[model samples]
Every structure is written in C-alpha cells, then in structure tokens.
Target: MSTTRTHPVAGRATEVPPRSRTSPPSRRRSSRTRDRLAAAAFLTPLLAYLALFYAFPLFRNLDLSVRGYTVRNFVQGGAPFIGFDNYVKVFTSQTFVPALTHTAVFTLVSIAFQFAVGLALAVFFHSSFRLSATLRALFLVPWLLPLIVSASTWSWMLNSDSGVVNSLLRAVGVDPVNWLTDPNMALVSVLVANIWIGIPFNLVILYSGLQNIPKDLYEAAALDGATAWQTFWRVTFPLLRPVSAIVILLGLVYTLKVFDIIWIMTRGGPAGSSTTLATWTYQLGFGSLLPNFGPAAAVGNILIVLALLAGLAYIRLQRRQEA
Candidate 1:
C-alpha cells in the first residue's frame, strides 16, 4: 500500500485522548431532573391548597391566641394578657378537667370496641361468600351518611320515650333509663353514637388491608404446618402493621376532634359533663348564646398544639420505619 503518513499533533503524539466522562452521566442527571420536575408538578396543587387553606388559618388562629385585645372585654372580669392564662384555665376549670377525663375514657373505650368489631366484620367479608360485595358496600353506608343525620337518628333511637333503645331496654325488663338525659348515661350515649359512626370507617380500612395481603404468604404458612393463629400473627399481622398504624393515628385524631355527634346528641349538656376539647372550645368561644372568642381561641389553640404534636410524631415514626 502506498503510505500516506500524516504526522500527529505535537502534544497528542504519544498520548491518546482520555474518554469524555460527560454524556451518560449528563443524561442520567437530566433524567433525574425531569423525574423530580414531574413529581413536583403532581404535588403542586396539594401544596398550594394546604398553604392557602390549612396553613393560613392555622397561623391566623395562633395570632388570635396571643392577641391581648379579647381580654379587654370579658363580662365577669377583663381578659388579661395573663400569658397562657387561657391554657391554665383549660387545665383547672372544673368542667375542662372532667370533660378531658371523660374524653380520654370515651376515646379509648370506643376505639377498642370499634376496632374489635370492625376486624371481625372484615374477616367476615374477606371470605368468598354470597353477597360479599354487597355486604362490603352496605358496611360503608354509615360512613357515607351525613354526620348530623346520623347523630339525629342515634338520638331518636336512644330517646327515653318513643325510641328504639328504650323500647328494647323495657323489653329486657330493665328500666328505660334516661340514655341521653342522665348525666351518668349521656357520655355513654355519645360514645355509642361515635362507635356507630366509627365502625364503618374501621371496617373499610381493615378490609382493604386484608385484601392487600398476598395469598402466597398464607399458603406457605399453611404448608409449614402452621396453625391459623400462627399464620395470622406471624404473617398477616406483620403485613398489616403499616395499615394498622394509619388506622390508629387517624382514629385518635378524628375521635379527639369529635363534636357533631356529641353536640347534636347531648349539646354538651346534663351539666357539661360530656364535653371534649372541641365541644368545650365551642362552648367557651362560640357555643354561648353569646360568644366569647378569647378562651375559645385558647381552647382551640391547645387542640391545635396537640394535633400538631400527634402529626409530627406520626411523621417521625413513618420516617424511621422507612429508613
């Protein structure tokens, strides 16, 4: 071959160019950027909504708590910037302490009953039985019903006169106690109504969790000579832990803020015995035939702090589990 010898450039003569480390890494970086942008685009509306509605109102409420103006006008005495006087009142007021105690007892009892009953129902519906689909839909009806209507219906049912509960009690040869009127019974009445309302929600969530469980896990457990209880505790319960956490957290939050049922059922009545933080706040600030905003704001502020703490705890727990 007739040779064409072109001399290499001076600096490059003895050394070849190192490979450029840019294109693939640059493409990967661009891909990641696009993914993050896509994710942010999806999240934009939710963030905007929270900022506008929840965050703004929360700050406004915090502002109301510290504003020293409301005390300038209490009828019994002037509202003072007693810095946290409102909170102090919430703890010490005869009504507040008992009401809080009642709320704690009510929430614990009702949640336990609802969870047990709901879990049973979920098991019932998890089977491939006739009307399973129809039954699942039926179970959620209580959840779908309007709150006021449910409360009203429950009130009517528990009425001392002309109500189903009383009629049944009479049939059982027990006196038709003042289910809603008696101070001893009113909180229980409220608890009953709450349980009725809460059951459907628990059923839905637990049932959904049951459905998400893999069939193969159960099959494997069975093949290992495991009893049903063993399989459930070892496999099913472990799998259900995340969903159960969600259910418990939400149940506490909802139960703590519960108002409509108690409000309609008892109106915080029979001596303000059945009041919760939410209802007490309403009574203090706005539930009066004439409203007082300062203490009400204070009560509301306490609830906000508690709920915020609960939410933060949940977030931390979730992060720890994820990590």
Candidate 2:
C-alpha cells in the first residue's frame, strides 16, 4: 500500500513528491555561475581600458625598443629586429650618466623640501585662524597654474637684469644673480620651481590626513602630560606615516617622469645641465636634429622599469604595514 501525506490545508490529504539529492548541488552551481557572470560584467570595462591604454602602449614601446625603429622606420612601419642593441647604445651614450645623476638629485631635493615645507604648512593650517582659508586657497596658485605658464613666468622673473627679483635685490643693495643663465644655477632654479609647484599638493594631502586623526588621541596624549612637540613625535608622527608614505611614493613617481618644467624653463639648457632621463628621452626621440627613436624608446623603457620597481616596493610596504 502507498502512504499518503496530509498537508494542513482544509484537512486535505495529498501525496508529496520525494526530494532529489541532485537539486542542492545543481542550484549551487547555477548560483556560482550567476555570481561569476556578475563579477565579469563589472570587471569588463576596467579590463578593456587597461588592455587598450596601458598594455597596448607598453607592448608597443617594448617592441619599438627592441627593434631598430627610427623616424624613417616609423614612417615606413618596418624595422629590423636588433635585440638589446638600442639599450647598449643608450647605456654607452655620453649624456646618460649625467642625466641619470641630475634626475636623482632633482627628485631627492624636491621631495625633501616639498615634504618639509608642506608638513609644516599642513600643521599650521590644521588650526583654525582668521584669513587661514584665504591663505590656503592662495597657496594653490602654483599648483593650479599650467606648467608652461609657470615656467614662462619664472623664466621672465629670474631674468639676470630686468627681473623683479633682481630689482628687489638691488633695492636691498645686493648684486643681481644669474638665475637661469649660469649652468650651476639653472638646475637649482628648476628645482625651486618644481618644489614650489609640488608643495601645495603635499599640503592638501597631508592636511587631509591630519584632519582625519581622532581628537581623542590628542586629548589622551595631553592627559599623559605630553607637550606639543612630544605629542607630535609620539602620536601624530606615527599616525601620519601611512599618508606620508603614499605622498612620497606618488612624488617619486611624478618626479621621476618630470618633463614639462625642465622642457619649458631651460630646454635642458646651459649645456644640458638640467637634462633628466625624461628630457634625454625627448632629446633622443624628437629634440635631436636626427631623431633616434630606438635609443629614445630604450631610455623610456628604463624609466618604466624604475617606476614599476617603485610601485612594487610601495605595494609590498603597504601590505607589510597593513599586516
């Protein structure tokens, strides 16, 4: 005899179907597929963008760096495969070492001063005061101005004889200084301009970081009889570190590929005193009377490698810090 099951509905007796063991697994499988499809749908645009913009350019540059590509070859779209020859040429070039040296100096000095001044300003502006808002807004002038415009303005202002700076110095009974004309000072001048431009960016970022710190921490430090300096060193410094790391890493990357300021201000002038890797690459590719695209691409690849290493270091450091 077959058994029947009664469901509580109007006192009715109904037969129920047996449950299948395969149903749960099949449902889970369908759910997982739906999740995967959703994830892919969300990721598709970003992946497409990376492939088109970043991956494509990187591979193209790598290809160009390996081959004997030149302006003629660029027009003709054909070059002989000459592996590592271009890199050898770039390494052997007379300007490479000096350009590398200048790049290091510029990046280091600019980062130091920019961070110091920016941190000081950030700390100061973190307090509420009259005209503080206006001052902060005005401080963004250098950051907001176009690179070409800033370069031109500074170039004119640093003029040996006719500049306002020289005029002010003369008024103060000081002799005129050669800002951009002298090779010794051209790099210094460029560094100053870059530092000025970078300061506001650092200030904004650091200030935001400062604002994010809890007031309770500061109060607790005060309760522990910590003076302002001690509090900063003990509490503020440690907390600010992550932001500082991010800022410095970003500054390093931006400074590494700096091209506009040097290009506009001096054109690597006073005998290439201000030329960095970026300018050197530009010089090789287009600034030269005869463009050597292969060596230029090789130099660019070198820069890309350095940047990639920096990014990797940052990632590792961040992960360690999080841990």
Candidate 3:
C-alpha cells in the first residue's frame, strides 16, 4: 500500500509505504507459540520423572499385590492373578494384630513426645540467652546425622552388656535393665531413638513458626497481666496452630513409614515385638528365603492407604480452618 502527501519544502506530492495491519497480530501469535513451547520444555522432565518414579512404581505395586508372585513367577513374567487373596492372607495372619498395635503405639508415642520436647526446646530457645545458638545447633546433631549412624549408636548405647547406659545404671545402684533385648523394652528403645531423631525437626519447624508470631501480642499479654502460661495458651498456641498442624501431619507421615531406624536398631526385635508395617513389609518381601512378594505388596498398599487417609484428613482440617 502507498499514500500521497505534499512535500512542504518542495511543494510536490510524495509517496510513502503504508504499515502492514497483520504484522502486530502475527508477532503476538509467534510470541504465544514460543511461550507454549518453553512451558512444555520445562514441564517435560518433571512429567517424565513422576511417571518413572512415582506412577510406575505405584502401578507395579498394585499389580504385584493382586498377583501371586513367587521368585520363579516374578522372573518368568507369568505370575498368577489371585485377586484379593494376598490382602486376605495379610488380614488373617497371626502377626497382623501385633504389628498393627506396635505401629500405632510407635507412631503415636513418637509424635507426642517429639512434638512436646521440640516445642519446649523451641520456646526455651526463643528467649535470647547466652550460647542459645550453639545449644540449638547441638540439638540439630541428631537430625543432621545419618539415620543408620543414629540407629547404630542407639543400638550400641542400649546394649544389654558393657554399654554406657548399663554402666551408668550400675553407678546409680540400679539393675542393668535390658534395653534392646527384652521384648517388652525393644519398642521403647526404638521409640526413644526415633523421638530423639525427630525432635530437632520439630524444633526447627516450631522455632520458625514462633519467629512468625507478632511481638505485640506478647507485649499486650504482659500489659494485661497475663502469666506466661496464660499468654502461651491464649496467644502463642493459637497463632502457632497452622505450623503445629503441618508439623504434626508431616511427623505422622514420616513416623508411619519409618523403616531404617527400626530395622537398624532392633531388626523388629526379640520375638517380633517391634515389627511395624514398614518392617513387616520388608520382612515379608526379603527377610525369608521364600519371599511372599504378594503379601508384602499388600502390606505396602495398606500403608499407602493410611498415609493417603491422613493426607485427606489434613486437607479437610485445613479447609475448615480456612473457612
């Protein structure tokens, strides 16, 4: 396209090229296409990772649970599909009740003590004092250490003979109680180790939560003559509810699937006393010469279901709080 104009100095008509109307829209379309390409490029790796690591494993486990997979069958690739027999077998097994009870006790007790001790430590560290930073760092040693090392150390410390704990007991003129060997105390010993390891996590999280609280709230509480206990219950705790909820939820999930600590410490110990679902799954799958892969997968699925339920409950609670 062209246009005509009168040249001011020359007093003659001039011609100019017209702008294309389609260019801007075309550029915009190209920009959108590039954006879409970049987005897909970023998303492809994440999608592949999820498919490979999470989705496929979940599908495989579900398949294994429904099929009767012996060693021979697993390799041969023709495991007989047995429907829900594996789940039924797991439900009817003699160890089922004991394992459930132990799991419940271990998880509940660990979460309770860990949260309590961690909250106390968090509050204590919240007050500015000498060496507080050092002390808090020291507290994180357990959390920072490898789980295997922590569990191994606990095992050594809690050994029935020639261990530091028993030597201390003898010094105090008390009987050397069997910490790990005794069936009754095996779970307790593991719980103690787990609690110690978990406290630092709670402390870090709760301390961060405390840092988010407004100082004015505490000042107001003091101005109103509220005692520390009253102020904590009324203000600090209420303010900390969200952090506490997440900490508890995460703790629940972590504790439920705790395998390495328990396995290393007790090997689900004396007379199968400390066996939780996590250890039981391993035991069923690989502990014996004749592995029951189907039953193991079934147990794993049960744990998945429990974790899913807890997540759902947490989501529901969060929604209610938001509402």
Which candidate has the top score in TM-score? Answer: 3
Give the 10-residue window scoring lowest on summed lDDT in candidate 1.
1-10
Q: Cα miss at 32, model 3 (Å)?
A: 3.4
What's the CA RMSD of model 3 in angstroms?
1.9
Q: For each candidate, how many residue pairs have backbone atoms clashing (under 3 Å)?
A: 1, 0, 0
Residue 151, candidate 2: alpha-carbon lDDT? 86
lDDT of each: 0.82, 0.92, 0.96
Model 3: CA > 4 A from native = 4-17, 23-30
Considering only N, C-alpha and C atoms within 3 Å, which residue pairs clash in candidate 1?
A: 71-79
Q: What is the lDDT of residue 315 in candidate 2?
A: 93
Deviation from truth (RMSD, Å), model 1:
6.5
Which residue runs of candidate 1 sit more than 4 Å off their true CA positions? 1-47, 68-82, 319-323
lDDT of 1 by residue, 37-140 (tens): 99999999999999999999888666556544343454454445556655666677788777778778877888888888888888788879888899889888
Question: TM-score for all predictions?
Answer: 0.81, 0.91, 0.95
Query: What is the alpha-carbon RMSD of candidate 2 to the true structure?
Result: 2.6
Query: What would the per-residue lDDT of candidate 2 be over residues 27-56, giving only the tens digit for each residue?
Result: 999999999999999999999999999999
Candidate 2 regions exceeding 4 Å error are 1-22
> Model 2: clashing residue pairs?
none
Task: Give the per-residue lDDT of model 3 (tens digit) for 47-95.
Answer: 9999999999999999999999999999989999999999999999999
